[model samples]
Every structure is written in C-alpha cells, then in structure tokens.
Target: MNLHPRIAADTLPVCITPDAHVRLMNDNRWPWLLLIPLQEHIEELHDLTHEQRDRFMADVNQVSRVLQRFTQCKSVNVAMLGNVVSQLHCHVVARDDNDPNWPGTVWGFGTAVPYEPGQADELLATVRKSFK
Candidate 1:
C-alpha cells in the first residue's frame, strides 16, 4: 500500500517490510511508533483479509514487545484512532507515570519535543537491531 502522504510527512522512517511500515514519531516525550499495514484501500481492520489480519497482529506484537523491552515502560498503550487520518494505523506508545500525560491522553496535552541526536540514534539502532 502507498503510505498516506500525511503519515510520511509526520514520521521518520524506521524499519519497513512487505506487510508493515514502522515509523518513529517525531515527538520524543514518550517512545512511540506508528504502524501501518501495507494493504491497498485498507482504511480499517475489518477491511483486511483473514491472512492480513493475522499478519497485522504479528506486526503489532513485534512493535509492542520491542517497546516494552527497551523502554521498560510501566505500561504500553496501543491505540487505533482513525478520526483525523482515515488510514488505519496503530500507535504503540511507551508510558510511565513520569510522562507528561500520565493517567491521561498524550494528545493535545503539550507540544511535542523532538528527539535529541544521541537519543534518536540509540533508539533507531536498537529497534533496527531487534527487528533484524
């Protein structure tokens, strides 16, 4: 599937495969990923075929486990809110009480803080290694 222009514009490419596009959110406040299935015209989960659904869950689990392992987050939040971007995407966010939006939604709470040089390098490297 062709990635939505808005998604390509918003995130930095991390790792991608035939079935999924993995990207790191520009905001570094909390470790996050936007996972999009590479299936044509799949605007929602129900739109996917049974095989696609199975593969999609595997992809989600991949990202979720990686985030939990590296971040050691108190909890990991997985959400698929397609309100603004009609494209079906899952947000795998690592969170702790220390995060800015603790006990609340991370959206609209504050401006996103971009990742620093070293932090970005380390994160991308670790994630890439895990996927390999």
Candidate 2:
C-alpha cells in the first residue's frame, strides 16, 4: 500500500535507509523514528510473511541503534500499536528523564514542538550518518 505522502523520502527530514521508507519524528526534541512496512493489507505483524517479519525486526533494531548513538537516550521504547492508523507501523522513541514529556508517556501529553530548520537539518544528518 502507498504510504502517506508526508512519510515519504523527500518529505521526511532524514533518510536513514536509502531504499527503506523511513520517517523522522516531527517532534524536534524527541529522537524518534517511524518505520512502516512497505506492504499492502498489513494491519499487524502477523500479516507479514515469516521472512518479512524477520526483516522488519532487524530494521527496528537498526533504528534503535541509530537512536541510541545519536540521542544518547536513557532508554529506548519501541511500540507497534495499530489502533490509530492500522497501517502496521512501528515507533522507535528515544526517551530521557529530562525530556519535557519524560517520566511520562510521550503520547497524549501535549503538543509536539516542531523542529527548527537548523536543528532538523542537523538531526537529519546525524540520523542518516547513523545508518552508514
């Protein structure tokens, strides 16, 4: 299935995996990445073949490594909840106790602060470099 245009390469601030479709978090302060499986009718992990599932898990790990290196986060939270979009996407969130939304869940806390142009560029570069 086609992904949201906003999640596409050109629109995303970072391009970690050249061929793999990746989306950088719009929340500037939080080091986050969203990985959407490039498959149609995939509402859950079970929807994917065994091989595809393995690849997806590996991709998640790769993204975690990137977040760990760049953000130096105190902890990493990975979740896949299809309640909202139902598109079978995974979220890799880098969290720290010092973060504004930290010590609490990132969801439903408050509005996300969009990244500044320069900050976004730097983060984009860092994430892209992490993949290499």
Candidate 3:
C-alpha cells in the first residue's frame, strides 16, 4: 500500500489523537491550520468508522477553539473540500474582513508568504502550549 507523503515526511504537527496532525502554512498574512486525519484509506468522512468520525470532529472543535483564542480572528473558516489534494483533510483558516482576500476566498489568490523563523517558532509554541 502507498503511504501518504505527509505521514512519511513528518511535516505537520501532531495532536493528541494518533490519527491527526496539524500543518501550519507559512503564511504570515493569515493564521492557517491544516488538520489531517491520519487514517490510511480514508477518502471521505463516511470512510471513517462512526467512532473515528466522532473523534475527528472532536479534534476539529478543539483546534478551532484554540485558533479563535490565539489568533483572535474575525471569522474561522473550516473546509473539507478535496479537489486538489484528494485527501480527507480539513482547513481551519482564521480570517478577517480586512484581510487581502477578505470577503472572498483564500484559495488561489497569491503565493503564500512563508512564516519568518522567529514567528514560526512562536506560533508553534503557542499551539503546543494551548494543547497542554
């Protein structure tokens, strides 16, 4: 069986759930978080067992709460569309009306501004601390 590249690369930050991880997009303009369910064959929500599905939702809620508290975003946009990656993943983006893509979608607008080294460390620390 083929492995998800994400799992192999160990690129994203893992949460308490064994089957979930967080990927911080290197975007300074927006606080974007990717929640990936670590099941190997899950292409959709129904692909998960009922219990697994419930657990996924719990993870999503917890992440959303943390993002709201830390980012103080005007709105939190959670999406599960798999048009590009074709993986069962969720995007929890913190948005504001004043943002560049404000009142519009954040996808395909422009290149992502990679997070600065110091800021990346800080953001990672904030998320890690929140989970404790």
Candidate 4:
C-alpha cells in the first residue's frame, strides 16, 4: 500500500503481489510496464534491504521476460527514474527500432497513445496468466 501519489494517475493497475504492483503504462504506442514495490517511503532501489532487493529484481525479470515473449519487442528497456513520481519502481519497456523514439529514450518524447479497452484488457490478462 506504499504507492506514490502520481502512479495512480499516470498508470493503470494490472495486478498487485506481495512485493510489487504491476501496472500498464497507459501508453499503447509502446509496451511499457511498471513494477512498483509496495515498500513504503522508498524512493530508490538502494533503499531496499538485501532480501527486498532480490525479490524486486525477480519481479522485474519476470515482467521483462513476459514482455519480450508477448510483444516480440526488439529490445527491452528497464529504468527507475524517480524525478517525477519519486516512488521505488522499475519501468520495463518493449521497444522496436522503428518506434518514434527509436535509438533514444521514451520519456517525454511525445504524447502517449493509450491502449484501447480490449487491448488493455487482453494485455493485462496475458501478464496475469504468465504469472500463474
């Protein structure tokens, strides 16, 4: 329950486990996934304890693998930028060279193209299925 203020507004909920909250980036242009650890008052990865860090990384890997498998993305990008949200979270982006922001960063590149209702639901379902 230690989510940051901006996450709810900027992202759509996908699922919540003991260690992290999995969310869709709300951008359909790219398959951007987020893993926000449920640890309270943490703004950086280093703030996590050793065990917590391990579990967090595991969650990140799980999401990254599923993203690659499902999206057939050329490359997967992972990052944790706290400047805006200030929460301890990881972004797992599925990128292709042809993308508008190709060979560069996805942040602040342009306005987000959100997922259609069915697309979003299907994506969420795929991710949840992968976990099981």
- Per-prediction RMSD in angstroms? 1.3, 2.8, 2.8, 1.1
Q: Write the per-residue lDDT of candidate 2 for residues 33-103, one digit (tens) a residue.
A: 88888777687989889988888888888888878877789999999887767678788889999998878
lDDT by residue (tens digit), candidate 1, 1-132? 688888887788888766788899889898989989987777888888999888987888888888998889999899988888899888999999999889898877788887776777777777777767
What's the TM-score of each model vs. the native? 0.93, 0.84, 0.85, 0.94
How much is the lDDT of residue 121 in candidate 1?
Answer: 77
lDDT, candidate 3, equals 0.73
Ten contiguous residues with the weakest lDDT in model 4:
1-10
Off by over 4 Å in 3: 1-16
lDDT of 2: 0.74
Error of 3 at 67 (Å): 0.7
Tens-digit lDDT string for candidate 4 (49-75): 999999989989999998899888899
Candidate 1 C-alpha error for residue 87, in Å: 0.8
Q: Encode model 3's per-residue lDDT on 1-132: one tens digit a residue.
A: 333575334234534455476777656778777777777767787888998888888878877888888878899999988776666878788888888889788888887676655776766677667667
* Count of steric clashes across candidates, in order: 0, 0, 0, 0
How many clashing residue pairs, candidate 1? Answer: 0
Q: What is the C-alpha lDDT of each candidate?
A: 0.85, 0.74, 0.73, 0.87
After superposing candidate 4 on the true structure, give the runs of residues whose Cα lies further than 4 Å from its correct spot. none
